[model samples]
Target: MNYLELDTPALLIDREIMEKNCKDMQDYADREDVALRPHTKTHKMSKLALFQENMGAKGITVAKVGEGEVMASKGLKDIFIANEIVGEIKLRRVRELAKDIDISFGLDSILQAKMVEVAFEGAEKKARVLIEIEVGEERSGVVTEERFTELLDFLKQCSNIELLGVFSHDGHSYGAKDQEECRIINLEAQRRTLQFAELARKKGFLISRISIGSTPSMIFNFPILKGITEIRPGTYIFMDASQANAYGNFTRNAATILSTVISIPTEQRVIIDVGAKGLTTQRRTKGFTATKGLGRIKDWSGVALENVFDEHGILNHQKFHDAVQVGDKIEIIPNHICPVVNLHETAYLISDGKVIEKIPVDCRGKLK
Candidate 1:
């Protein structure tokens, strides 16, 4: 089937570009001597996760227990929930998952550890975990050295849990003003994570995995840092407009929404079939890159997705008067691909205008 025949507002993945993105990251990890555990949240599909494994990813990382459960159900053995899974119901589910596969999650607080301990107490296998260390992201994880030591001590008392190592995300690197600042952020983030790992090892804990990654940081600073066991990068698999803006290259963006111009409402404005529903409202942040408006128009350079309704996307550009007309098709490189992917049921794999395969968004709506 031809890509144009697939209807409007369709999510398309370019086969060539997607394969290169996965292989390039894997090769970089191989050269750096670090494990590449590509985060599954971006694509949210078991086939893509399995494709990463086939390309030499050490494991796969998911943001929630539900995502992990979906991956595990597809026979993915090694999985990491890179977010804190708290509450009795969540922890009980985590324990049940651990019974079948090598399951672990991020830990930043003692309250979370206590809950995990209770969830797995007297079980045959303990819940494996990686203590999250704050590394300038300030989103989650233990920040101070005092909090780090205290959390380790608390985990020692938890008979139903086993500490795997440490993990950190230099998410702030994404907001870096330039490559120089991104390099600095990545270095500091890794340094702080390693310091916490060393402290845990000194405290008689077996520190095995020292993981750190954010696509912006990893792309700029791989093979520079040593002693890091794994790097978990999610967005690299499907480069988005924001990533291309920060990292400089839209050519690597494999995922895009194939939208068609439905109406030329005015000389300066055109409406596309996709809206905020298909192309998420996320935009490129200041200091990251200089992409104006909401999303980048793939075929039209100066054009942008100026605004969106639930069902209609507004494209306004002075050039729209001659560059596009009613019923003309255009592809939109989303400001963010992760959320945009979740909004779709299936993604059509395309190659040179031909539809190669249809892949389900298997983990779509797994928000538990």
Candidate 2:
């Protein structure tokens, strides 16, 4: 019944902390009039996705079709794939899901739209679509208004596709100089989505949703400006070391990797059981909150453990290393929680140090 008894290298979630985090974000979104559609890519658990929906989330945001398939099987009514969905097989799968749920995904160009149009030709329903605007994050999406307009026209002519709305991820905010930069990124993202939505409306295209979000930036999106309809932030549900460093320590980030001290190589060096396989080396952070190591030691705050091995983590903390031993258990607040979650099959939901429930990482490895 206790999470400690479960096993080593286990994914642990503090239920109370997770609940508080969700509710707090929901409340913030409600106050701002922005629909909270938390991203399910971080947890990769449909149960957690449903949990977000139950906590005032309008829907869940997924990054891949494989993830959408897993969630749809669990009866999730609405989902938006925030990333571009390509490939014929993947598109056909998307069409198949359109028959069951309110499915939509990101589009950057008409060529991608053409691929979808062909895939949905024989489908029983049309695909819901959203044009992802590149507000600041240089990942994907139409970066200019002209390009945005071009993509809209392309999708509008499609018989099998319906233009639902426009969305943007203010991911660039994470690298800002201060909270002001975060606000500017989100504000500009909202402005871009709204601008495109207005243009589409004027052009006689039906634009119903105007979405904008980022976990670090959404914390400042409370004053809901006009035209912003939805907020899809995934990290708010489970805070990580990077997020904690970005948003401050008050955030309710409840998930962490519970590892064991495998060896005390020396007084200044220690090895943890968790390695690249369990915790990834994704240091996709920005600004002063950027992390130099693979992850931070949760039990020992402020210790960013570096020198990650394939099967071991080399921590360079003299006092911290001296305090740990070969068999002592330690919790890691990973640099990036998303990948760490994908490596685990399940998370031990803990309350008061006891395992209350075991939830599968249902959407884990849904990279297709």
Candidate 3:
């Protein structure tokens, strides 16, 4: 069936473009001599994650423990939860998953490490973990060398916890003013991450993997530092309006929302069936990835979603209003693909305008 026949407010994936995206990222990783561990949090689909693995991904990265569980159930052996896992319930889930898979999670403090150590006590395998270093994203990570040293010292006494390496995300690269700025942020973040890894090794810890990534940085094809081992970029799989703005084009965008024109109330006002619920209200208001509007209308140059409500999208363009009528189907590229993907239950894979396959968002809403 063609995508046009599908219902309104549907998620669509262009298979050909998506495959090229996967291959190009893998090739980039190979050229840099680093393993590609693309994050599954972007798509939240087991089939797509396995597709990435088949395309030479060393492993997969997830944000939440429940997402890791879903990927594991789908036969993903090597998984990394690239966020701190707190609480006994989530830590216990990670411990259970570690029994059969090479699973690891993020840690930034001694308090969190102690919880992990206790959760993995008496288990067959030690709880593997990566120390998160703050790289100017202002997010969760060890901000000072003293804090990192203290955490490492406490972990040395834990019998059930094993320090695998250190990782950092230059998420601030997304807000870089230009390519040069993005490059500078990427290099500094990687350097900082490597510094942490070297410090761990110097302290007699076996630091193996040094991972760093951000789609804005990785997309530029910058040189990887000497000690970095892996890159974990999630949004590269489905470039959105914001990323396209950063790249200065939408050629790399592979995912879009298929929506229908529901009303033509005025000469300059057109309404679409999809709104914040389907396409999301996300907008990049600063730097290179800054987007002009809520979403961009695919194939409609200079046309954007002016506003959106819960069930309707507003497009105020004289040309757009005159060109499209009610019942006309149009595709919209979201501002941020990650959260937009989690809003849908399934995605239709399109090839030459036909629906080739339908896959479920297996890890959607797996926030725990």
Among the numbered candidates, top TM-score falls to 3
Model 3 misplaced stretches (Cα beyond 4 Å)? none
State which candidate, 2 or 3, has the greater TM-score. Answer: 3
Poorest lDDT segment (10 consecutive residues) of candidate 3: 112-121
Ranking by TM-score: 3, 1, 2
Q: What's the TM for model 3?
A: 0.99
TM-score of each: 0.98, 0.96, 0.99
Sort by lDDT, best first: 3, 1, 2
Mind giving the per-residue lDDT tens digits that candidate 3 earns over 90-165? Answer: 9999988988999999999988888888888899999999999999999999999999999989998999999999
Model 1 gets an lDDT of: 0.88
In candidate 1, position 196 carries an lDDT of 91
Model 2, residue 184: what's the lDDT? Answer: 74
Q: Residue 236: error of model 2 in Å?
A: 0.8
Instruction: Give the lowest summed-lDDT range of ten residues in model 1.
Output: 218-227
